[model samples]
Target: MPEFKQFLLADTAEGLTEAEILSVRVQPGDEVTVNQVVCEVETAKAAVELPIPWAGKVTEILVEPGQTVEVGAPILTVDVDPAGGASVNGSAPAAEEEMKPLVGYGSKTVTTKRRARREVTPEAPVTKGGYVPLAKPPVRKLAKELGVDLRALATSVDGVITREDVQRAAAPAAPTAPAAAPVSSGARERRVPIKGVRKATAQAMVSSAFTAPHVTEFLTVDVTPMMELREKLKKHPSFAGVKLTPLAFAAKAVCLAVKRTPDVNASWDEAAGEIVYKDYVHLGIAAATPRGLVVPKIRDADAMSLAELAAALEQLTTTAREGKTPPADMLGGTITITNVGVFGVDTGTPIINPGESAILAFGAIKDMPWVVDGQLAVRKVLQLALSFDHRLVDGQQGSQFLADVGAILADPAMAITY
Candidate 1:
């Protein structure tokens, strides 16, 4: 007789009610060790890896990938004493005292790893014109962008193509013809199942747009001084290893501007009939990931120096792009910034993120002719737009806040006075 133990989904973090099973790493009869990740799940905020607590052979998997399960639900069962001779009730004496706690269950450190996927049958080899390559979607997209034909690469590693293979193939590449357009002949309408992050984002956006009265204000400024400062900072010892960009300056400006206009860092509490003003700022940076838009916050952003802010932004964006941002980092945001300029587009009216009163949109920076005193010269210029909850932030406050941000960007020295 073997003692079976059930592994329930523990509360991974605060405010997480349920998660969608992204992948199942183990199956029945597989031997697993304690703390080994058994599956991955995606919550409304971030994707998380769940580790099994008991070491044993898997007896059964209760949940499948893509199915949402609530916290405390039994996800899998394991036989602790697979060699037999255990209590009939499946209780191993002293099991509780011998088990080690799983890391990151309630801590800031997050563990994320995927087990090696089971190999699939090798597809047919490539001919000249009709060969399909073995690669993930992102790897294929990279190959297409780099003008490397995946069919040309030799599949020596488990008959699968990887990102490194695509990069190596593109290393000594010459100019190649544009990729042929994808040909399709069928009904144009396609129905995409809206679930996971996409579904949550759609619902939040709809609610915010309808519930909050939005007001947008725009300002155009000469950012020549800010650009010059960035170039100088890059060579400075204190700023070494920091990838400072216009966004950093914009972030710092928002922090300082919020001090002057606290309403921008507030939330409208209609049910309570009170406006909640946040004394501290958890600055949110909106990142467009493969899944959808995710805004991960930098905690206590107003207290950080320029270098610290830059590093925080870099880490936040990287985590988001890799689809590993923890759900805790996506909550409690006081205000947000969206850089549409990265895509080479000018500013647009951005909607306020739910729970936050204001959002800023940074537009493309361009060199254009401008009047300096009485002389015309080409200068770095930027367009900025701020959207706010009109109920909390009136037109006057919105204008002042946007103007202050523009002023700081136009002249970095003004930040000291602010």
Candidate 2:
């Protein structure tokens, strides 16, 4: 005898209500170990890998990739030895009474789905010859989502209708050659469903744009000294293997400038009727990934040395681009920096993140003619744009913060005195 058990989808991160299935790592009949990654899911915050708690034969995969599931919903099922295999993961598996029911499933008779060959219900209409479509619950759900009628295909492919059957049936009708003239080939338009990180980022941007009263200020600075120092540091023995990028320098400058003008590191609490000023700076560096735009933070950036900030920046950007940034790393950011310069763009008014008071857009650095003490010379120049919430930061504070950052970048020596 074999005991069947279901492993429900738990919230991977705090406050996560739903997640989209990125991929399924195991198939039916596959042996799995405890704490092994069973699947990957993308929540609003970040992409996360979910591990299975049970070590047994995977009996079923209840969800398909591209499907979004609510927390506590059944995701997978496994079969364990019935005689005494209850302690698959050490202590006796969590009792059925301990599992929390899926949200919105109140008082509904919960039942596990069985193999399609088991039985057909009366509600399921039978075809002309009493042939009821045999498909698992997950396949049926997929068919419904794609607007495919399983009954119409009752001339059943084989025995049980599978995921591929539903997909093949749902595909658009092939373009036929016209009798009068040959029809043109290929689809000109492409449509992609917006459901994952892109969808979440859109909603967040909309909310931030409407909720926060934004004011953007721009400042152009001569960074000849900064660029010169970068070259000198690269040759130094201490900076071996360090990525001393302009973005890293900008991040360090932002952290230092925050100490002189703390308003940029504060947030407005409408409900609490107060301004929340943070003593420690959690600097967020916006990185664009293949999935979408994500801002991963460097904690207590103000306390980190320049070398440490550069190392953290390199690691953070690499992880983010690989889509492995943890959900927790993307939260609780006090201030943000978007390096538009990476794309060779000058500058733009960037939108502030929801919980943060301000965001700085670092532009591309290039050679420009400048008046240095009544002398015209070619200097490395870059533009900086700071967008802040008007309710939390005023014009004077924002200008001061921008000026302080520019001063440090123009002359690294100023950082020592500050």
- Give the TM-score (vs. native) of candidate 2: 0.76
The lDDT per prediction is 0.82, 0.81
Per-residue CA lDDT of model 2 for 5-57, tens digit only, reads 67677655555556899999998767888778888899876788887766777
Question: Candidate 1, TM-score vs. the true structure?
Answer: 0.75
Candidate 1, residues 1-418, lDDT tens digits: the string is 7777666666666645467899999988788897899999987777888887677788778899889876555677678877884423344232232222245574332212222332323364556776565676546755765788787777545566776787787787668899989876569866676777886788578768977889998999999999999999999998888889899999999999999999999998764789998899999999999878999999999999999999889988999999999887888899999999999988999989988999999999999999999999999998999999999899999999999999999998998897
- Model 2: clashing residue pairs? none
Pairs clashing within candidate 1: none
Alpha-carbon shift of residue 258 in model 2 (angstroms): 0.6
**Candidate 1 lDDT trough over 10 residues, lowest sum:** 109-118
Candidate whose TM-score is highest: 2
Candidate 2 lDDT score at position 204: 67
Would you estimate the TM-scores of all the predictions? 0.75, 0.76
Candidate 2 clash figure, as a count: 0
